[model samples]
Target: MKKLTAFIMLIALTGCSKLSMDNYQLLKTGMSYDEVTAIIGKPDSCEEALGTRSCVWGDEQKQIKAAFLAEKAMLFSHQGLK
Candidate 1:
């Protein structure tokens, strides 16, 4: 009942946060991290090394990855994460 309804709502909201191709197409090299996040929602995972950062959005079936250097996007890609 209430718990099941709440769970469904949570899943719906989570699905809405996933990245879309329209937003992904808007990404460009040299865009800032904030700009990229604005297009796609917050990343599901992120990692950084040696002043470079990589962020990913979406689930295992589909995902988008953006790499940043100096706080600006240097590379981007999207595909099935599986």
Candidate 2:
């Protein structure tokens, strides 16, 4: 039964179509990090450790790759200077 359910879910996912900012006018590329952050507020999830910042948004990486999707940008500091 679990296998059957999983198979069904896979089929549904393959058949369905998803949309993102590509279909909307609100987001675009080359915008400043601050501008993107102001519009999106915050990322769904983020990692800020060891002078590295990573953010994840949307179910697929491709979606986040779209314009102005990332809401957070980490400024790395080495020896207390960015």
Q: Give the winner by TM-score.
A: 1
lDDT against true structure, model 1: 0.86
TM per candidate: 0.73, 0.33
The collision pairs in model 1 are none
Candidate 1 lDDT, tens digit per residue, 37-81?
A: 888878999999999999988866799999999999999999863
Residue clash pairs of candidate 2: none
Q: Give a tens-digit lDDT track for model 2, residues 1-82.
A: 9999999999996674332343223445455556545554455666555544455444453334322233333221111111
* Candidate 2: Cα lDDT at 9: 98
Residue 65, candidate 1: C-alpha displacement in angstroms: 0.3
C-alpha local distance difference test of each model: 0.86, 0.44
Superposed model 2: Cα runs more than 4 Å off: 1-19, 22-33, 65-82
Deviation in Å, model 1, residue 60 alpha carbon: 1.9
| Candidate 2 global Cα RMSD | 12.6
